[model samples]
Target: MERTILMADGQSFYASIEKAAHPECRGKPVAVGDPTRRSGIILAACPVAKERGVTTAERVGEALAKCPDLVVIRPRMQTYISVSLLITEIFESFTDQVEPYSIDEQFLDVTGSLALFGSAERIARLIQTRVQLSTGVCARVGIGPNKILAKMATDNFAKREPGGISELSRANIEEKLWPLPVHRMFMVAGRMTAHFARMGLHTIGDIARLELGEFKRRMRARMGRQSDIQAEYYWQTANGIDPSPVVSGMRSQIKIINHGRALKWQTYRTFADIEPLMLELLIEVCRRARRYGYMGRVVAVAAAETDGQRSSGFGRQMTLPRPTYLEHELSSVVRSLFLTHWKGLPLTHLHITLTDLSRDECYQLDLFEDRSRLIRREKTVDAIKERFGATAVIRASSLAPTAQAFERAVQIGGHFA
Candidate 1:
């Protein structure tokens, strides 16, 4: 056995979060998504739904075709995000080598922190228990000698046990992995699997047995140098030679709302989901506006279809009535900007951007508006909320969706939908 890393997969991830957050939707077939007329992408499906072949990225319409009684639920992106953050905080308590893989997935290079926590299984159990206790959600953990193997191992055995902490070792790899289909080796999703199958290379062990030159020559010779390099890297992964340690202090990147809805050959069915997603994006844009001490010269909303084609609308160079840094005021303008240009296409992704940047000045503030008082008051509110967290501060306008969305913003790197 080699020193191991741990991978935490959300165990049905989106669906699990939805079920955990909303108990009433637990038992039945629940699918979380935003079914806009333009793009009704399925984000997650619960365990029951999984049995019915309802999974993420299946369109609301296609899913219905498969299971007529399927229950589709609008996502609480904000809430999910908040839970994600809480999970992150909890993870930090255990190890510094935590790499956030996605909103709901993370990799813990617990090599150094092993002594403080004890064995890998102890830490895995600790993380699993704490997650269940803290968020009322259960996670499936995979422990192995490298990130890839750990992730794959978790996926292999996590859900079978009570609190999924599946371990993969040389013995298990030989017994369980070498025999499985090559497509089962992750990162081999989509077309990669098809290409391999056509060549009669059916198992990971089969692919591993071939010479690099023969492998490349036989496979239509399109495996790029990077792919070739990855092939070698994967052997290290299979043998568990990964030594990459986590590094921190990277600048926190800009926020993004990347929603992908499955489609009937890439088309949207409605517009409801995009509305909230756009609203969420606007919130981030405004928050950034305030942080940078200036209102942007442009407000833009762009939509990308499932195929990666995109279209966007540009707002007028509207100056803020009061050059302000308040989410309440700034988001109001952002909301207006988004709505005006929203034509509602089948968009898989909606992005709101603020550019043509400039600093704040007196001319931007409203003379009759008591601007200073409002901003000051809002600032106080922000400070209070920052201290006590989002649930403490709720504006009347944001009362409906803001609670879950805001909680997720500070706590989870959730896109506020």
Candidate 2:
């Protein structure tokens, strides 16, 4: 039996929430922005604002210039999170097999619910009405036989269609989906579009029709020897051949754990000023790694300079002699990478990542260090934080003027709590 999947997305999620909260702003031009130094950009713009030439990710100053009457609201991340959770509950009412694609979008396998709900379209309409009535945010839904087609239909057709619902299937893909420009397809962005154009593959139909072997060969010629996997992925997407199930509580395996922070302003320039921030970030990364019961063999560090116009940065990674989830071990590698690659520039961002992970069930015993004591100490810290809070026990460096971990603990997604 063909699976019925629906991808439901909130229309202008953040702005819609603000409008719903402030009823006076309904049907007016509205945008939600982060009023912080690091990101004074518009996070979401309502349809009314978009019509007035406002766009998300543009600076608030630019958005204001485009629409002088725009109602700019600061982001309330916690409220938005609450709303997202509420929406999840609403989706759960329909089917047990609902997966959140993002805060604003969800994929639901209603194949099992059709008998009770009538039809997928009917269920989508009911969901849309309930979401609007409950949250004052409109919803658009895409229906398909699989997840990929449902997602593409939502982005390409459903959001634009009058009914705010559209469906695509293998049977009707050639007529309805294949004629569009290759870039309009899901996962085909500007860079991929340029590559496809050079290969004379200008439409989804073009790639969909190609034999798998030929497609991989052409992709190899352009993207080099390691392009087979990516080439096959795009081919399967274009043909709408997703065999993946819409699993409830679905989680992709965690391959890497990282911690990063952007400064409120670019003031720290010297090595002395930046080292403390790096230490704080590295500690958090290590803590998370230990919490996940994983030890990583590779450590990567990145520091970026945020000038007003353009961004310049350096990222470097080094392999460890032995896999470990201890900050003391990773700190040496992070320090070497930062000092070796970073030029003497004003830095505003710091990031550290742990990869090449393996189960931390055992570790190679070291001759110099008390491995047993370190492991016990780390576990004690993790337990303390888990029971109390993340900030219940933190390193002294996090109290320094340059450190962000202390302040960040109170915030969500780098915004005010």
Candidate 3:
């Protein structure tokens, strides 16, 4: 039996959520972002805002200039997360096989539920209606035989359709999807589109018409060795021949654990000024490794200058004497890396990564140090935080004026909660 897959996405997710919450903003232009911050850009904009020349990722001031009466709402990350989860529940009610492609988009495999429901189109409509009625946020759905086509159908067709539902299949793909510009296809952004055009492939049909071997040969010539896999991926996507399954409760294996943050406008020039934040990041990274039941033999630290130049940053890694998920061990190496590499340039970004991991089962003891006692203390701290909140039992250094842990606790993605 052919699988029935749907890619459902919330229309203008953040902006729509803000509009739904504030009844007065209905039918007016709305954008979600904070204008005062250095990174203040329109995160999401409603259809009304888009029609008025407002675009996502544009400066808030630019959006305001476009739509004079634009209602700018600060993003409530936690609230958006709650609504996303609610939409997931609504989707789960219709089918057990649902995979979240992103916070605003999800894929549903309803092949098994066709008898319980009526048709793929009907199920798409039902899911759309359910999400809208429950959350007051409009949903657009694209139905297909597989995930790639479903997502493409959503991005290209469903979003433009009045009914906000469209279907694409291998049989009708050439008629409906092929004539569209190559950039209109998923993963074919501006640069790729230009490259495709240079190769005399201006439309989806152009790529699809190429023999697989010829396409791979051309891609390899331009992209160099080992480009065959990526070349084939694009070819498959163009032909709507995805074979990947919609996995429920999907989790990717953790090969490395890392955490990093970009400073909005604050640039630390002194080692003393940067130490607290770096320590906090190292502690957090170690906590994550411990929680994942993994220990690493390598630790990496990165510092990027505030100038935004690609060459301004330094990233260095060091192999540990042994694998351990303890904060002290990681912090010792990270601090050394920062002190050695940071050239007194004003730093706007900091990062810590743990890699070369193995199962965190046991550790070799040292003759000088009581390893078991330190391990027990770390485990206890993890236990307390798990029982309470992440910020419940923070290090005393977090209380320092320079520390970002307390501030970061309430924010998501560097924006206010």
Candidate 4:
């Protein structure tokens, strides 16, 4: 059977959610970000702000200079996640084969649902209307025979039009997809684009017209051993011949969980000022690791200095004598790593990563530590936090004025609310 996949992406997601929560901001120039921080960047901008030349990741001051009347609001990441969950639920009503691409984008395999819901275009329109009416956020829907084409149709066509729906099929590949620049095609990196340009291949049609062997030869010389695979994939994509399936419940395969925070201001000038914050991050990371019933053998710590260019940072990784999910064990190693590597540089960001993962039950007992007791205590703490709230139990160090744990516990994705 011919597949029918749809990609649905929320338009100006963060700004839209802010507007939805505050109806007064509608039709006004608005952006979502931390306006209080000097280095704050625009996370998302409404259509009005976009029309005034305000763009995402642009500095707040610059964005204000572009549109003096712009309304700046802090991001409420929890609210956006709630709305995304609602949108995902709506997609699930249409098809079980729904794969979330991000916080504001998802892919749905509606080939099976077509028999009950009508044609692909009809389902696309229904989903768009449903999302708008239910969430007060508009969604652009793109329909295609496969995931790549659906995403491309969304990015290149649907997002630019009033109807907010577009379709790409094998029959219209030449007329609709070929005229676009090669750089616009999915998975075409800057180096690949430059290589293609050097070969006088500027459009999707140019690449599609090359013989498989000749294309593979050129790609090998340009990209190395994986060139044959990359060349074939790109050639097929150019011809609208994707065969990948839309997958759901894929998060089970995650091997690492990390948490990083870029400080609101460059306030840490010494390790004394930085230690508490790093401890808080370690606690959160360990809490998550225990919650997921996974233990990691490797701990990686990274720090980025305060320079606006972020040219200086240190990253170091160490393997534990035994895998652990306890914060105490991980924090000891982290503290050692930071103190040894730090050069008294004013830091803007800190991150902790846990990797070399295995199931929690796979760990071997340490010869010196009371491993079982520590594991039990950690699990008990996790249970309390899960049942009550993140701040129900806090480390005494977190109570220090410089620490951010109390503030972070109530926020989502390191943003307000």
Query: lDDT winner among the candidates?
Result: 2
Question: How do the residues 1-417 of candidate 2 rate in per-residue lDDT, one tens digit apiece?
Answer: 799999999999999999999999978999999644334889999999999999989998888877889888889999988898788779888998889889899999999999999999999999999999999889999999999999999999999998999999888999999999999899999999999999999999999999999999999999999999999999999899898988775434469999887764365777777888888888888888888888999999988875556668998899999999887888888998998998777787888999998768778989999987998898899899889877888888777787666666777435743
Better of 1 and 3 by lDDT: 3
**Candidate 4 per-residue lDDT over residues 1-417, each given as its tens digit:** 789999999999999888888898878999998988747999999998999999999999999988998999998888888899899889988998899999999999998999998899899889989999998889999889999999999988899989999998888878998999999898887988999998789998898888888888888877787778888998988877877889974434559979988985467877778888999889888988888878999999998876555457899999998788788889999999988887667888899999988767557877788788888998898899889878888888888777987776766536744
Candidate-wise lDDT, in order: 0.65, 0.88, 0.87, 0.87
Candidate 1: where are CA atoms >4 Å away?
35-39, 65-69, 159-163, 198-200, 211-227, 234-239, 248-417
Can you give the lDDT of residue 339 in candidate 1? 58
TM-scores for every candidate against the unseen true structure: 0.55, 0.60, 0.60, 0.61
Error of 4 at 55 (Å): 0.9
- Whole-model lDDT, model 3: 0.87
Assess candidate 1 and give its lDDT.
0.65
Worst 10-residue stretch by lDDT in candidate 1?
256-265
TM-score, cand. 3 vs. native: 0.60
Q: Is candidate 2 or candidate 4 better by lDDT?
A: 2
Off by over 4 Å in 2: 35-39, 250-417
RMSD to native, candidate 3: 13.7
Q: How do the residues 20-114 of candidate 3 rate in per-residue lDDT, one tens digit apiece?
A: 89999889999999957635889999999999999999998878876889888889999998998899889988887888889899999999999
